[model samples]
Target chain A: MDLRDPALYAPAGHGDAAVLLALRDPATGALAFPRTPYGIGASGTPAEAAEPVELSGRATLLVCVTVHQPLSPGMQVPLVVARLRLEEGLVIDGVLEGTEEPPPGSAMQAVLVMQGERRACRFRLVGGAA
Target chain B: MSGLASMRPVRVVGIGMHPYQFPSETPYVHLGLTALRGALADAGLAWPDITFAAIGTGAIGMAAGRVMLRHLGSTGLEVVQVENASASGSSAFRTACLMVASGQHEIALALGVDKFGSAQRAANKDGVPRLTPEAEIPAVKFAMMARAWRDRFGLTREDLARVAVKNHGNAARNPYAQFRKPRTLEQVLAANPVAGDLTSLQCTPRGDGAAAAIVASEEAIRRHGLDRRRAVRVLSSVSSSEHQVADEGWSLVEMVQRSGLAALEAAGLGMAEIDIIELHDAFTIEEIVYAEALGLCPLGEGAAQLRAGQWDIGGGRCAVNPSGGLLGMGHPIGPTGIGQVTEIVRQLRGEAEGRHHPGARTALAHMIGLGSVAVGHVLQRD
Candidate 1:
């Protein structure tokens, strides 16, 4: 299956779960998401000194909101966007699985789903964890 | 790192604007020149009197200063273009103030002008791929902020809509505002929903316009015989960018708080001494959140203040965004910040006409740009 953004995540070779690609600063133990080539900004560690790591794709939903209109190009209406705190202590924004806004502090995990012709990463509430 | 106060005093002797309006076929040169001419006329000075010009623009390409100023006849004045996203105008004004205060130039001009739809963001060109590009949209991002505020502070949708109501009403009386019609709470709430609880009326309208401010040293003011009573003294200028915070979502708020406090401290005044504030209100929630961040009220008390009419013009405490702010006055990127200064100067001079806030002797102008930067200035009468 083709992933929407191959640099961000990859299949975990099980169910629908995926592992998030990230970079960790060796000195300060800081984490940066999406694995940019420019290296970690917090510690000023060069890209070569930064170590690649995979996040558990598990997070606690910090906040969520539903976009009622197609504000961006090629955006679908009623999209759910949320800020989540990863278990590794990094915060990131992602698309939620449902149209409804989940209450803050809900448990969520990354899952790969079909978006048009390509598979994309979306966050779903952990079962019985709301 | 001495503040403006530590240097020679700089005062704003003239301010002018070409009313913000919807995108039109009118050339940007016309918009910019109109503002320059107006400022010169208001200052009772000729174009040659301006020894330095700082052009603030977001979309207009290279050498914008020379291209626009050449029509006024070249006098070999120093020209530089400043671009700091929405705070471009504020940055330009700060540059002009510094030049005058440093004695590098006796007279300086800060002019901001821009049109809609042509500006671009550097984040897109950084080559970083995102998992959710839609989250980058400002309205969506701010919607998430509104939701977070609602969850943490129990902010109601009506509480957010009331900001639009007040600013829109203020705009109704402002001749230069893009949104000149007053909107009721119902009208605001019923407006087209753009994101989450944020309606279209709660967002700043995209348009084109221009604003200019002229700053001069006391020596120049006296030599030129400028009216000292009309001059508004610039007490302090402060600029800063976002810092890493525990809550990444509130980084912008942290920047505003730090910059605002620094500005007031540099000016040797407290929040109580500030009778007027013109801040970046591109969205309704910003006015509430930023005001609280700037120490206008404690956290979770902004809505209550708005409810009590404390933030209203002439309603007491301090009038926030008396020029209608970006929500009603329109955000033309570069021009918005200088326009804020123009409004504050007008109010301080008792010349805001229909929208004047009585006894507005001291004012603060705060602006935030795309780089997550904040710029603040404190101005006072006499």
Candidate 2:
């Protein structure tokens, strides 16, 4: 897949327009620019047919990503996040929504939490305030 | 700690908070005064009627109590400012409660105001003192401490994941909470580690907020015609710090253990007698460490009890942070202490909806601050 193929990396769904948003349970350490382990390539990298996005995959995670809005205390999206999981639940630092930027200089991260196997719900972060 | 008023019992006549968020063009004094007004309104009393004011804030960032209260109009009463790190406001509130409960004053007000939490604070160029070194803010220093604890206990990252999961679940139910949503272990463990294993999520977010509680005496309660259902009295209050810089006996466990003993004894109660508990879970691991220190469970035995659903809202013995805590809930220094008390008050009255603690009559509000300071308050309906 080409790196700049617009179709593969279109902003997936809810919270796609903003650069930062609130992360609820999946805690991102920083309050500002809170990251996520649930987003996929939104605008840069094209998803391949043979390789599925997983959270437990043991390797560098470099992909284009986008969201509907910045993560915030009361925000959630629809099937917008694409999580890449590697083995052993070994979550690489660079793999989180690590800031919604493009790939190739994305500073690779190891991730063990991939999107679940349920459509829409399969790859979405469902959330509400406690 | 005894009086005729104490025998008759008392209740929270007022409650207040500076909205939990970054300050708008709104001045800190404005926020503080707003909460003062809110507390007075809640207590159904007039400002002229408030006999005493015990206010708290931090540093000299605007005279904390004095400047903030000036905005509330003129009051020719003695005003004392309390600056106890994060626990500043609650300590002051505790003072007011004790005064009213002891029949010292009929109508008293407790104010907690922090305008600098969300906004940056003025740096002390003369090299101001800090709980930790200049290079280590709270998250970094505590993360280092947590790593040390893990190494000592032989605990894995997976073991700590449960803390985030449990707290987030409880936070999801608190409306006044800064963060009120549930989280997953995977998500928590995966978040950015501010320092070592402490992820950004595990650290409390800084926000701006205030909480105020109006304390009234039984005579004042009768004078003001306040209701009983909303009445909750101070049971026990303890204020102490980590045994200062002791090489041989320095332990957070002992500091908390001694403080808990004093507070419980003052209230004539025990850990098992508490129906609801509100702890300072600023960091995910702090919950576990303090649970043991407070004698809720044996040291290192917290994880087992926590995993057993023993501390659920309706469980016989419940430890909670219905305001999302500092984890899922936001942390705005001064008001946080009063905020904790506010939650316990709600719990005692069975007023919580989304995260109700059924039939809760007694509750504990406890917090630990930098400099190893701790304050525990016991409140009961009887």
Candidate 3:
């Protein structure tokens, strides 16, 4: 994943579904979305993980990247995206399902960013005194 | 063969639903069988009379349709499973109705059931594409859409509040619904926001439940001496999903008008003929967005309709959700679509004592699920 792409711009209250056509370079642990197809709104959530996943055509990817608030919990619950690869594939991406948030504590603000109508927007994930 | 879209005058003989709560004692199969038993009893039919069965559910791994039926003594008849996002149950019912109406089957049963499994477990590697999130959680993304609607339509807090108030009143009378308690508009505005402007009541709660319905053709109904009064005719059934457009060039209201037009056409009726509607109200804002989409009201005019008590049960031109809907009732995934169908059946039959639509002869059940998909089924009492 590009560490500096507009997708990483996390703000609270902003989110949706987008089909990201990504090619993962195994050697570098890098992911890139050359094309994206987003729906009117998100039908489901998406996530990526520490595991290496090869992308096929335009794999569905979720990139909440959590907005940490002083009261909000941190990035403990990993997001998940499925049906990623178009053809040949390996190693699942994103966090496992049913992964709950970690214990509360001091929290930094977390902003979630996703592709929007014209461009990208940001919002903070409020609530939680972690 | 003309598919389900061509069939007509589909009648529901039996209907059943499991409560919207976790089943502590029943296995998934047992839950389904029990619902089947209830439906058979409701329809006054025997298991052997059922010529076909369709099951809608998301959690069951494979042959979900056949396994659940076998437990209930379902003969090795045609059994199909429907997996249309959250509308799985309703899709199954529609399939059965098509079969019976097309003369492919004499009697058919559609049962929808689901257990509370992982929210988003890995999906089947079907050829069909699944909606992958690009950069937001489901709640956040939906909230964004709500925000966009507010931004575009200039909806006010009262506009959203009307939906909560309307659904809560509907929910108050639903016995099997997850949340029967009522809420006022003031309480809704004061509730906490899950994302953007989405308060707690705006989103559907997750629960566990199952529901089933039996549909038969006019010939079969007459031959079997079924209760004609309780028979609910299937006017039309239509399903569509996101065509993968950037923003769906047309507005939500227009899309629903497209779907509503097809449904009304298939039923040989008009929107004005629809007495009560169980359209998708997964979120409070969705009611605002989708009511317009379904052509229940004009563009940017849903709040005014609610303000005028148009969507209320006893109000004029009732487009309703007395089962609390996904909002107050708790959406148990698969069962929701069937739950909506169940509500329509009850309303048409005048069996819903506390939450009846008051002499509704024609009713509609509309549901939208994952994939930006939508399904509409029209029903009328004999």
Best by DockQ: 1
Report every candidate's CA lDDT: 0.92, 0.60, 0.64
Fnat by candidate, in order: 0.77, 0.00, 0.00
Candidate with maximal lDDT: 1
Model 3 agreement with the true structure over B75-194: per-residue lDDT tens digits:
768888787878888788878887887788989989888887654533343232323333235555555456556656777767886788778777878887877878888888877756
Docking class of 2: incorrect
Output the worst ten-in-a-row residue range by lDDT, candidate 1 chain B.
B244-253
Q: Please state the error at residue B269 of candidate 2 in Å.
A: 0.6
Q: Model 2's chain B TM-score?
A: 0.88
How many steric overlaps are in each model, in order? 0, 61, 28
Candidate 1, superposed: residue stretches over 4 Å from native: B247-249
Docking class of 1: medium
User: What is candidate 2's CA lDDT for residue B324?
Assistant: 68
Q: What TM-score does each prediction get for chain A alone?
A: 0.95, 0.21, 0.20
Candidate 3 chain A minimal-lDDT segment of 10 residues: A62-71
